[model samples]
Target: MTKIFEMPLYPYTRTADQDAAAPVRHTAMIVGAGPVGLAAAIDLAEQGVPVVVLDDNDRVSFGSRAICFAKRQLEILDRLGCGQPMVDKGVVWNLGKVFFGDRRVYDFNLLPEEGHHRPAFINLQQYHLEDRLVARVRDLQRQGAEIELRGGNRVQAVDDLGDRVRLGIDTPEGPYTVETDWLIACDGAGSPIRSMLDLDFVGRVFEDNFLIADVVMEAEFPTERWFWFDPPFNPGQSALLHKQPDGVWRIDLQLGWDIDKEEEKTPERVIPRLRQMLGDEVAFELEWVSIYTFQCRRMERFRHNRVIFAGDSAHQVSPFGARGANSGIQDADNLAWKLGLVIQGRAPEGLLDSYDAERIAAADENILNSTRSTDFITPKSEISRLFRDAVLDLSEHYDFARPLVNSGRLSLPSVYDGSPLNADDALEGGPARTRPGAPCPDAPAGEGYLLDRLGGAFTILTLDAEAPERVSEAGIDAARVALSAGDDPTGALAERYLGAARSAIYLIRPDQHVAGRWPAYDEARIRAAIRRATGQE
Candidate 1:
């Protein structure tokens, strides 16, 4: 394979023979058009950088894999302009019910005490989310964003050209080559890109297998998620049933005893188990049924050479908390700006180093969180099962275990200050130190904008009253960037929301995270921070 960068992208001159060559150069070439891959393409295009996305699948998927979206994921999608439509189509659950056998033990509301600024997480099928994202990417492509979608094309191999990257793509017509500035692989867990780079994924595979059944039922069930710790129908297994969009329900039956993987996936076995769990009174039509085993793995590194991994290509979680696509989208959001900046010559190529470090940190945390969740729910060993039962038994009386019972650790935003791109200890001073390198916290701003106004684009906020004018004098673009002055923010939000400080300036990334902020206003610091946030510096 030719090196990705040195290779010519577009045809300089056409050949007259039967075998001809056409070269078209792109700013970036992305592998896999799943939700994560397409999201990266759209984000890069939104930044005025040209992109080409290729996928082997000819159409969208019908079977739903991931069924929930966390608040942080929703915030990231909302910035991409897809959150509202998804929220409109998907069901939002504020509470979930956990059953200790036939008895209804407790009901938990996710964002119970937190105000309306941050509501509960959403439950939407992975397919619906992808469909909406695909539509948006198609629309963006139509607007001449240079985002090319070749659905039937597959990436055969990628070679780093030092200054650029080259790709050899296989299509039904024949083989074609694309040379681009950088390469991002959003392919799945068994990623060809990750394989080509020889990155080892380190983690464990759980022994338990889950029988997943997607069915459409006529009966009315609770809107909240219902999880049976150990139902009478399956003594050693867990049974769960949740409401999906348009009367569709998802039921999972833990296959306690081993069976032939091929023979058990049929609806005949899955239906019998469902009837056993819910009894004969529940009538339903099983739309799809499959067997799934959990795998918790993360690559030692997310980036190798010029080929960077996103989505499942970098890491995979047990889907206990719907962290699979959620983390992948987060990965795309983080890399989009950095890639654009490096491609546009606004920032050094070293900025791309953060893509691996920050995302890996997030992926590691997600794997740990999700794996812990799946393990706790589906304990493998007999002793572990006894401990789990003891914990659930203790929940009956112990008030101290309530926090453990209501563990919401998976829903929190990941911290990324550990990355090389983040210089929290730099000369920018204190206020910049406050933001760190994590998802920007949602604080209620004035007017109709509120928390919604802070995302989807670059923003500069001044709590000092004098910093706004000082930043404006630094030649910041006002059209795409919003300037806000928090002279006397509400006391309710003063300490917890926005900190009380002077001459403080915050530059928020497109992903709605505080990329960099400073307590003191310096022209070089402001421009550099804004450039770094927008992928310009």
Candidate 2:
């Protein structure tokens, strides 16, 4: 039998409430110490905002939950100061193969070309990611970043005033109430705070179940995602295989709604099923098993008065596309900068509304993709299954039907197309890939990557033309480069940013979203764009 992972318990500490102390007020308080909450604390502290994080549990997650981390999420982690270690400890891959019955239908590469720093996807356990973020938070605390992480503490009640929030926290010693200018809830889907406020999570719940098992074995399988529909061993069912760190393999088997959940997870039942797929003689040990039913749901709004919601508390999606945790990290990234500015009184309160707008749009997009993937994988009616099998059969021969296959569209950064913060499309005949409302694409910049040079605050990217001295006088960060015609070294930055002939200038937000772009540097227009991006206009 494979040894189960043993997590150390975090000791509960005495708080000021146990003693006769006055109520301590904070600039911001974050509830839940999951990946999203830890990330939010780090981002806010890095921006010079004092933060306090509280969680009921002390250690990281227990199992290999939420393993697939996308490149965009890795970039966000890098900005928070812990991406490199996660990448070093993760299994990186870009290729996936889909099989129809016994024959290979098609194979595709996510990132065919590689001039970037991070890979398309990395398979690291969610616990490892949370540990790294927690460590980063501690490191920042030693460096004078005012971040206090209190474990074994849960928020029993929350009272939201017009301009501040009051949290009644329960600890081992006693209960105490503290006030904060703002409250961020990173609790999971069954959030008590959401329930206390009587907020309803609205969406569709699929009636299908999927069994996931982690096995420790020495196998010769390549580092690629292998998926099968109606394999010989498990007829009329779908199976997925993925490689993870530390000689572990994740196998997901589709189970219909009629099966008993508890009986299916037993080793006696699971080992036989695995043996049917892998040869009977192959040696392996079952590490963990879980049964899950897919759901695509989200709250109507993320922001509620002085209290805000993030991560699973705000939205949720099926695991098919690996969108749940990745999108949650993006949500924290989007809200941190805006919340920091609001706490510092640098912007108006209306700025918080934009977070609600953009993240709701992103949640809708994720839910739509996840629902489509679940439907294709677990078809409801006979007509749906017929069409799915037809597409898979034709994909083996015809290239046209290959795109019709829906085996988890895979997570990609969403573009906020209708964001009120973006400038109107002004420049014609330039690179539309990095257009307004899109995340800044990574490109070779000097010895590093483009995204590495463009975060933490507002920046202006000027390429191929001389930046006027008056540009900096406008009080905005500018990365100016005047490249010669034949001096195209990496040959990617200019092409991706489309700054070939004349000067191309782009105003970037703190979260690295492109606010506006112009062909020439205009100090007046750039400042105006900055105001619009920050909700100051």
Pick the lDDT winner. 2
Q: Give the TM-score of candidate 2.
A: 0.95
User: CA lDDT of each candidate?
Assistant: 0.69, 0.85
Candidate 1 lDDT tens digits, 1-537: 432222222212222211536545567888887789878988888888888777776555556677778777777777776888888888788787776777666677777544245456777777778778877877776787777667667778777788677777776667777777778889898998877666768888887788888887876786787777877887767777778887778888778547777688876677788788767998888767788888889888777767788888888877566688878888898889777767776666777777777788888788788777787887778998787777777776776654565222445667777555443333233433245576665545564333476656556655533454334322334222333445224432334324454345566655666666666545677666665544344
Clashes of each: 14, 0
lDDT of 1 at 419: 50
**Residue-by-residue lDDT tens digits, candidate 2, 272-376:** 999998988789998789999899999999999988999999998888888989999999999999988888877788989999999999999999999999999
Q: How do the predictions measure up, each by TM-score?
A: 0.87, 0.95
Evaluate residue 198 in candidate 1 and report its C-alpha lDDT on the 0 to 100 scale.
62
Where is model 2 more than 4 Å wrong at Cα? 1-5, 17-20, 468-488, 499-501
Best by TM-score: 2
